[model samples]
Target chain A: MTPALLDAPAEDRLAAAIGEMARRSSSAVAIVAQAGSAARCTIDYGWLSRAIVSLEAGIDAGRPVGIVARAARVETLVVIAAACGRQHVPVAFLAEDSRDLVGQLRDWVEVDDSLSLPAAAAGERGRREFETVPPQVIVATSGTSGPPKLVDHSWDSLLAAARLAEHWHGLGWLLAYDATRWAGIQVWVQALLTGGRLVVPASRDPDVVARALVEESVAILPATPTLLRRLLTSADRGLLCRSGLDRITLGGEAADAALLEEAQATFPQAKITQVYATTELGEVYRVADGRAGFPAAWLGKALPGCVRLAVRRDGELLVRLSRDTAEVGTGDLVQRRADRYEFTGRRSDVIVVGGAKVYPKRVEEIVRGVPGVAECRIYGLPSPVTGELVAGEIALADPLPENATPESVRAAVLAVCREHLEPHSVPRILDIVKQIATTPAGKTPRKPHS
Target chain B: MRPDVPNAIVTAIATVLRDTGRDTRPIESGMLLAGDLGLDSLDLAQTIVLLERSLGCDPFRSASTSRSVRTVADLIAIYDSAVAPGAS
Candidate 1:
C-alpha cells in the first residue's frame, strides 16, 4: 500500500490531485457509467476540467453549496468538483427525494442531465486557486433509524484511508454505494486520486451492477454487507468470479463470520476485508485477516499517532482521531473474545425482553443458520407481561423441499436459537413474513417494533 | 364449485416447499402462512404464482378478496369463494 498523502499541508488535495492528473494525461478516462454490456457514458480528465472551470465561474467562493441530484449522474460529480475543488466552497450532496433540504443550505443548486457549460466560460481556466482553508465536503448519514444529519470533513480527513497510488492507472472501481454518501465519495476519491476510472451502474439493480463489474473489469468493489449479500444471491455467482475483482471491502453493517466466509469462498481471488467505520467517524480501521473482527491485540494500540482505540466499560468502542484526548463513540457494542474483539450489534438495536437484554443480531445470526431460512429480521414487540417480547420475521429460501412445512422450519429455527442463544433471547413469536422492510439507504430497518 | 381447488392449492404449496428443502407436512389450513410456514415475501409470491397456475385463476388479482389472506385457511377460502357457485 502506498503511503497516505498527509505530509503535504495542502488545503484541497482533491483539487490538487485532479489538477496534477489533468496535466499528466487529459485523455485518461476519469468516469464511466455502464448500462448493460457497454458503457453508456465515459468522461475524461480534459472534459472534466472544462466542466469544472465553467462551473467554478458561476459559484461564489467561501460558501457551502448543496448539490441536490442523483448520485449516479456525471453532472453531480462535476458540481462537486467545481464547488469543493475549484471555488473553495463546501458541497453538501443531497438525494433528489431528500425532504430536509431547506435548513443548513441557503445556497443550493439542483442539477440534472440538462446541465451544460456556457460557451463563453468554457475557455477561461488556469490552475484551481487553492484556498488557505480547505472547503469541507458534507455527507448525510444513512438515516436508517431517524432523519439524516449532515457531517463535514476536510479533504485530508476524507482521504485519510485512501492509499496513495500516484503511479497507478487504469484501475476501475464499481460505484456500489450512494455517491453522495461517505463510502461512495471514498470510492471515487480513491479512483480519482490514482487516475483510475469510476464505473457507475445504470441502475441499482443487482444484475446491472454485476454486469458493470464484468464489463468494466472493476478491480476494487466497496459495498455494504447487505448489498453484497443481495448481489451474491440474486446475480450469477460464476459471473462474479470472472469479474476480476481484486478486493471486496464491506462496511455499513456488521460483517458476521458467516458472510465473511461466504464472500471469501465465492471470490477466492479477491482479498475480502471488513472495515469498521461510521458516518460520524471516518474509517477507524480495516480487518483483512479473513476473520469477523479485528484481533484483540489491536485494543489500545495507536495507528501512526493519527488514531487510537479503547473499549469503554460499557463495551462501546471509543476512537481517538488525533493525538489529542478528544474521542468519539461508535455506538456499536463489541465483546472481547480470547484473541479478538467481535462486533455483537448496535447499542440502539438491543431489544430488552423482561429485564434481560437481547441483541437482535445475535438472534438473527442463530436463526439464519437454520436450514430453510433465507433471510430474517429480529425485533422486540410490546408485551404487557414481559415489557418486550422477542419476535422474528423470517423469509424461507426459495423452492423449499416437499417435506418441509412452516411449522417444521419454525421449530428448526426455534430449536437452533434455543441451543445457541439464552432462553430470553429466543424469539417468543416467530412469523414467516414475505419481506423485511429496508430503509432507503439499503439498511435493514430497526425501527421500534409495533 | 371446483372440488379439487383446495387440494390443488395445497399440492402447489407442498411442491414448492418440498422443492426448496423445507418441510411440507405442517401446511394445514389453520396455520398462518407467515408465522407457521415461515413464508417470506418472495416465497409467498412464488406460492401465489404456483397457486394461480394450478387453480387456473388469479385470486390475488381481486384486491378486495386477496387482502384478507393471512393464513392457509384464508387462502383456501379465497380459492373456494372464487371457484364456488355464483362466484364472479
Candidate 2:
C-alpha cells in the first residue's frame, strides 16, 4: 500500500480497527511461542479478546503504560494488544535493567509478570466499549554512548510503509526483535494487521531460533545483521534453510555488502531485503536489490511521498519523514561510491587516532572479510604515542587446525587487514577470543575509552 | 614455577607485537603488558591464545585467573599454577 492510501484513517481510528479485527477472526491463531521444536503456547484471537477484556481495566485513554521488555511472553503481547486496542494508551516498552525509565516513565504504569487483572468482572462477555484516543507507541532508540532516547509514533506513521497483501494474511512471521522496540513492533503490527501468525522464539540461541522457525514454518523473518550473522555461522543453519522462509528482511544495523552477498547465497529461495530505518525516523526506505546500500540517485530524492533523504557536508544522513520538510539528523555516516551510497558507520562511533578519524564499522567490515573470522568488534583504545589506537577482538569460526598455531591464524588475519585497510586504519592490536560481547539490543558493544 | 612457562609467554608477546608491526622489545617478568610493553586488550588476548597453544592449556580460562594477569610475572604464574601437580 502507498503512503497516501494509508493516510485515509486518522490515528485515532487504529484502536477501532483492532477491535474490528478481533470481531472478524476470533478463532484464528494469532501467536505461537516456541522453543526449538517444543510449542510453549499458542493464543488464538478468542483468547486475545478475553485477554484484552481482562486488561482493559488497567488501561486509561491517552495514558502511557510500560510493558517490561520480555520476548516470547503471552502476557507481554496481551498488555500491548489491550493497551493499544481498548484504551489507545501509548505503550512504552522498558528494558528490565534500564535506569532511565524512572524519569522518562513518570506517568507510566509498569506491567510485569506479576500484573493481574480481575476476571472480566464476573459475567462480561463479547467486546466492551473502547475509548478512541489517538494511537501512539513510544520506542527507545538504540544509542551506544548516552541514554536511549524515546521516540513517539502514531499507528499511521508506523504502518505507512508496510506492504499489506492478501497473501500476507495467515503467514507466520518470526519475532526476533524485542516486541516493544520499533523493529519488533513492526513485525507484530504487520502480522496482527493482516491476521497473520506471529512466531516468537523462546530464546536468543541461534539453534533454538532456527528450530522454532522450522517447527512453526515461519514465512517472514526480520532480524538484524548481527543476529543473522550468528544464525548463518551456527550449526543449525540447515534448519533455517529447511524452514522455508519466503522473505528475509535485515534491519537495525547497517547491512554490509559481504553479509548481504553471503545471505543471498545461503538463502537462495528467500527474497532478501535490507531496510534502513531508525526509531526516530520510522521506515525510511528499503533496498531489495541485494546490495550493500541504496543507489546514489536516492540521495536528495523523495521516496513515495513518505521519506526524503539528503547527506550533509560531513556525510551524515539527514532524513525527512512523511512529507515533513524538516529534516532530522540520523547520525549515520555514509560513503558515496560511483553509483551507490554505503553506510560506513555512526558519526558518534568514530575514533580519532593520531589526528585521523577512523570508523570502527569500516574497519570491522574489512576485517570480517578475512577467512575463519566468525565475528569481530573494533574499538579505540588509549595509547601513549597515538591519541587512540585501533583495536579488535575476533572470534574464530572454528578452533585452530591441528597443524596450525595461533600465531599462524593471527598472521593470516593481519595480512588480510593490511591488504584492505590503510596503515593507520588497520587494527594495531588484534586478539583472538572465544566470543565478542554484544549489547542487549544484539549489536556489537563499542565502548569508547574513557 | 614451570621452567618453560615464562619462555612461552615471552615468545607469544614478542610474536603478537611483531605481527602488528610494533617494536619487538625483549620481554621480562617485570614488564607490565599494558604500561611497559604497550599491549592493549586485543594484543593481550592474542598473547593469551598463543600462550595457550604453546602450553597446551589455557590458564586464563577462569575470570579470576584472567583478571589477575597484569604483568609478565602474573601471566607466567597463571600458566605455572595451571600446569602444577593436582591442578584442574
Runs of candidate 2 with Cα error greater than 4 angstroms are A1-25, A37-39, A57-75, A114-135, A321-324, A399-402, A405-407, A448-450, B1-16, B21-88
Per-residue lDDT of candidate 1, residues A1-450 (tens digit): 223333543335555566566777888888886644454788887776666665555553323244444344754564455444545555666654354853666545544454443233222223355545566666677776567777667766776888775444558888887776667777887887776888888876677888888888888888887788767755676677778888898888877888788888877899988887776676778778988777888777777447788889999988997876588888998998789888888998888866889989878878878877767888876543355667678878665657898778887887777678776787766668765555556566665442
> lDDT of model 2 at residue A298?
84
Of the candidates shown, which would achieve the greatest DockQ relative to the real structure?
Answer: 2
Off by over 4 Å in 1: A1-12, A19-27, A37-39, A60-75, A109-111, A116-133, A166-168, A401-411, A429-437, A448-450, B1-88
lDDT of 1 at B54: 72
Model 2, position A185: C-alpha lDDT score: 68
- Tens-place lDDT digits, model 2, residues A1-450: 224434445433333434456688777778887646555778776666566655665544223443333333644554455445445555666443454754766544555553443233232222337645565666676555576777666667777766577677668899888766667767877776666788888888878888888888888899988888888876466676687888899887898888888888777888998888776566778889998878999876778656888899999998987564688999899989889999988887787777889899988887777667788889876553455667788888775556666666677778888787766777766777777776667777777422
TM-score of chain B of each: 0.82, 0.88
Against the true structure, what is model 1's DockQ?
A: 0.03
Candidate number of the best lDDT: 2
CAPRI rating of model 1: incorrect
The C-alpha lDDT values of all candidates are 0.70, 0.71
